[model samples]
Target chain A: MAIKQRKLELGVLVASLALVTSCKREDRPFQTSAPSAEAIQFTRMTDFRAGGPSISGNQPSPAMSADETPEEKEFEENAYMVGEGKRLFSAFNCVGCHAHGGGGMGPALIDDQWIYGHEPAQIFCTIIEGRPNGMPSFGGKIPSFQVWQLASYVRSLGGLVPGDAAPGRDDDMHGGPPENSAPNQKPNDSSLPKSAEMPK
Target chain B: MIAAATARWATLADNDFGVTSGEWVRGTKSVLDPAGPQSGRIHQLFLDYFWLSVVVYVLVVLFVIFAVILRRRRARWTGPILAEPAPSREKLRGWLVGLATLATTIALFFLLAGDHAAGRAIRSLSTDNALKIRVTGHQWWWEFRFEDEAPSKIFTTANEIHIPVGRTIEVELHSPDVIHSFWVPNLHGKRDMIPGHPTRIAFRADKASEYWGQCAEFCGYEHAKMRFRVVAEPEEKFNAWKAAQLQSSVQPATDSQKKGQYVFLHTTCVMCHTIQGTTAGAMMGPDLTHLASRKTIAAGSLPNKRGHLAGWISNPQTIKPGVRMPANSLPPDQLQALLDYLEILK
Candidate 1:
């Protein structure tokens, strides 16, 4: 009986060892200081048009800032960063080209039919190394963290981000309309684009 | 005369508080209260038209009230008391029509006269041998070039225009992009800077003062912040400033400054900016040859102080949202070096 108990314990150990060895290595953003010079695994622009037209995740590490909270810790899940992105968007005059997501001189961002891929990493690549047709490259100008923040904020605009991370009101401007406001869920997921309703 | 005006305007424009509150300073673009001779005429003509319109409006309202009351009384007694009527009704109708015609003619005369006077005052104020300065409107800034017969005498500057007091400074305005209007309320009324259409605005300031001018038309994102200052100083000071601006890019003396200069030339800055005597001769952005001398950087968005300059270079979009100046992220030490290099530009 004692021998059988020893054999059972040995079997359990071998099974647990196999399970540990087979554990998947997760990709995350690396934690770094502000104005982080670390290279991000940005998606290539050519691949943006291929396949799903969405970005594929590489081996990314979670870049954590010192001054982050549980609620606003992960940049992907942080609502405050989205707010910061909104501010940067206006301040940088992204509205000048993009026209508040409706696209004027630049293409519309708040749509499903993305000319570029529909991934946060892909958008980050697009911003850093701008696409052709007058998309100015912002790689050298913008810091990596802020660029990431802007990318996350942009994703929120398209309703691809988690609803909780998306802000419902602007920091100022008194809780603007739907265009400025992001709802908990996409208001037009199934509906056709409002562009069709507009006079050509 | 220029010296006295310089002191007067300097006293009025030098505000201890800051730029926003500096509007109280007389040289601001206030259309109603003009400080220059040209704007004064425009203001006076505007007031004449304004008062006449007010008087006409009041009289018209009074007459309408009188007619309403008379009509009500006439209608009440329409049965017999008033129906057979006041004899000479035909004559009364003719008299009423004549009076209306006379009132209409008088109103039309004043309207036409005010329009004619305003147009003539602006047009006929041309002076010979005037100081020539060409103001080219960019997407977000004013490029001032002092024009002279000698090609070498032409020097370009941004955001600030220094004119000699008591002299007719004839400014030729043009735009490379969309429409922009140059209006310094204290100096002259708004004039559109349409692309391919050059417009001229000549103004002579009676007193020297720092006057604020802004792009009246909405060009783009940085339109509101596209401001320029007219420094109406003494003739000697104006000439000296203009002369000094002609000097080529002076080399940096300090090691830190030299490094900054090297970094600027080697980086994306040279792609858009031009610094005289340097390889950075691109004209897409402002000329930074005399950048340190300007009162405000980023086209009058912020003071040209060290901290503001460093902050702007670090991330300009943070300060002037939507401004074309890109966010060129640099290491802290390199940024400081660039600031140090720029500070000695004067």
Candidate 2:
């Protein structure tokens, strides 16, 4: 009777141990480190409505400081690289269908005839969002930097000096300057007369 | 029994048992002999294989029957069933060996012969002597363009391909949209027209006659409508036809024809067609710059008669569903004028 009692006690102890082991195996530990502020901001921005302004109401606008040196201004002005854009343009075989400057299967990029508008931002959008007939969208195919380079190449078509052109002038043919300008600031106005702006 | 008899009678009527009439029949004096180099090679190959098959079949059947009867009679005298070693094992092995040797020889011969014939077909002709013609395949039509001419001098004709008899003609085939096959059965076998790739077929017709062919590939909704005609004429006649095609489209002589041209330009016709001299420069469809010159319409499915032409213009989709050419609901007077203008496309 004492041996029987000891055997029952041993079985119960084994069962309790097995149960505790399985419970511990199934449990998952919570993450300790917090996500970066930039990542959290990006997720919030993407959740906004379609065609909404990229910036939120709370964030302050980017500004140029008085402490900015001549070297910095020159670098900012020279930010649009014409040489890199030209290399990317030729490598992508954009000329094969466009035919040097004359249109064949695709429209002429050099001419004033803008199907989606010749502004830099608009051109960028057009490149990212392709036209229906034949042009395929390169949004995901190319990197963001490469797209900006292509936009610069197209902007050069209008006789604009490559490095001198500002980054985000909305009305200027590079897709009406960049969208992230200061709250009240308007983009650079086009010098061409209203009559001359019309495409032939 | 009645139904079977009626079916037999219909079959008999369709069969060309004996060549009673002057019209051509299979296994009779050929309308066009397969005399060209490529066709001659193919014909000889076919005959050799056919005779070989007949001889082998007869010998095998006779041998099998003779062996079976002899073996059964010999075994009959022995007890009800004598367990003997397989007697025909050696014979079966010998037969198999003989058959394999025969098959290998025939296969090797065909492989070598086919390679040689294909090589000879594609071998380039002397530049000075060879005639070069560009054949473009559309949805349900063919556009023939003769080389050695300017863009303006380029004449667009459909359905029919004109060639000079006994002269080697090299045709470069191109397809604008989907795949299409060019075939002229009596003249030459079919060659496919693949997009972005030009395929060439070289052959000479031994006889001067019109041979019929249809697009062998099911290109689209109008695959059946995509028929072609090979009009093999004498050298002098071919030259004259070429010269006539190069000439400008004749202007409308009658007031009704003038009205038709106006209707063609103003109506939906201008949206899909092109006429070289007029404002109709749209290229969504075939160039009707020289439409009347073609012997048949709707590819080669319909004769180029006024009635068929009118019917096609009224409701093309009814005849060939899914056809790119839509039905033009025109007033009677406008439709008549358009028909008149289209008839003179030559």
Candidate 3:
């Protein structure tokens, strides 16, 4: 009886193999468009990381945006959009991973180690499509509008965006300059010793 | 004073630490007393090896006593058989030893055949008439997703799984964080849930009762406390549970409950959990849509009661060490209201 059962299982396994091989390849695109006409939502990505940082600089300046509408063009330098991203940075627990731009479980957002590059669009896509080490994609949980806000804020984290485009402080007690503050200054190279050793 | 202390300890035991002694010795956790066809086959194989070992032990002991120690050491002058110089019987002795060796080989072959039969009985994974469920293991919890051909028909759950009795259920096991094993001793043997690669465990549970399952693999700090329940029921009851799981969470009934709902959504609870129909759609933690219907909370760490729920909400780290959830330091009133809201999730 057991032998017969084993033979049956073997037969079933063979049949499944044939069925799977003959089936068409399923290409499940993870990029979901916005749900409401309010935004271009796709179901695959809408649920990625609702609270995580969004990558597509929600609204880059039309000049920088490949396909920016007038609505999207204003997001580039919009202080309100930048401020909203700052709030999302904390709410989605981005502060938990990339701690105050210094880094903890994730890389330092303020540093030069751009694992995925530093374009506004690149950052936006990086956030949506998470990286290997620790970053989780926040495509769905966070609306696309909020993702744009988050992208603008993340761009300002490394002083990549104009200092005026970043937020300094608020009711939420986030650490940094206001969106209208000074631009990021290059560190002085004069502090380094002329030689690679201490003066004798 | 002593009685009061004893009563306090008893309450502690009930809420934390161990289960009752009766439940341990002859409970659903016992692998010896199986309630499913797969488990029964495994138990039979275990007994087969155990009895075979016993027989081998007895035979070796008898050989040592009668053949080696008690045989003929005192014999040269006392035994006629020893003095006979049995050269003529050498062929006969060699033949006898060869026959005995042949018998042992045949016995071993049958034992191996029995083992193969047991393995096949449990792990066939044939699901033509079977129900399918995906069991994903997280850091210290279990997440269950019922399978359906249609995407909209599928629903996810946490901690508990309800299956129809006397029907094969194919469980696709995977782990997102670390390695873990699923073991419901009363139903089947353990199967490892690896990280990327998924495995299947197919079994037909015959009985209609709650079977306790625990993370048999050491996953992390809370591995020992990571437990779940398999509620095997009649087909109708199982279907009812599934139906309830598919629906969205109910709204709060009273004024305080509504206020509690506001607090829960506003707080950090939404950061890690999903309460369907609300803004709390994060999947970092378990689904809390049908939390109230479950028998226990925190993945079977405590009984689902008002005080335990309140205590757990206040300080999850105290009951189960290294749990991912941090203590929510809400004011007394807000905490009470949140608990009230959570109780109505059914």
Residue B158 displacement in candidate 1 (angstroms) = 0.3
Could you give the TM-score of chain B for each candidate, in order? 0.84, 0.80, 0.84
Q: Estimate each model's TM-score.
A: 0.59, 0.56, 0.60
Of the two candidates 2 and 3, the one with more favorable lDDT, higher being better, is 3
Question: What DockQ does candidate 2 score?
Answer: 0.02
lDDT-based ranking, best first?
3, 1, 2
Residue B293 local lDDT, model 3:
86
DockQ of each two-chain model: 0.04, 0.02, 0.04
lDDT of 2 by residue, B1-346 (tens): 9999999655444332221233322111122345355555556655666777687788779979998987788778764545554668768868988987998698668767866866565364333456778888888888777776466655666666678888888889999677999876565667899988999988777677666666779897778777767777899999888887777666888999999998887656775677877887766566777788776677765666787788888877666665656566578998999888888878
Model 1, residue A48: distance off in Å is: 27
What would the per-residue lDDT of candidate 1 be over residues B1-346, giving only the tens digit for each residue?
A: 9999998766554432134433332335566667777788888888887887898799889989999988888778864344455579868988998998998899789878877877788777667889998999987888988999999999998998788988888889998767999988888888999998899988887777777889999997779889888888989998898888999877899999999998787656765788998887867678899987888877777777898788888777777776655677677888889888888887
**Tens digits of per-residue lDDT for model 3 on A1-200?**
99999999999999999887534222111222221322232212223434553455333222233242334434446565676577667767898888766688987666445556555555665666576667775543344555666776776776656554456665544455554453454422132333544687
Output the TM-score of candidate 1.
Answer: 0.59
Worst 10 residues of 3 chain B by lDDT: B18-27
Q: Retained native contacts per candidate, as fractions? A: 0.04, 0.00, 0.04
Give lDDT: candidate 2, residue B63.
78
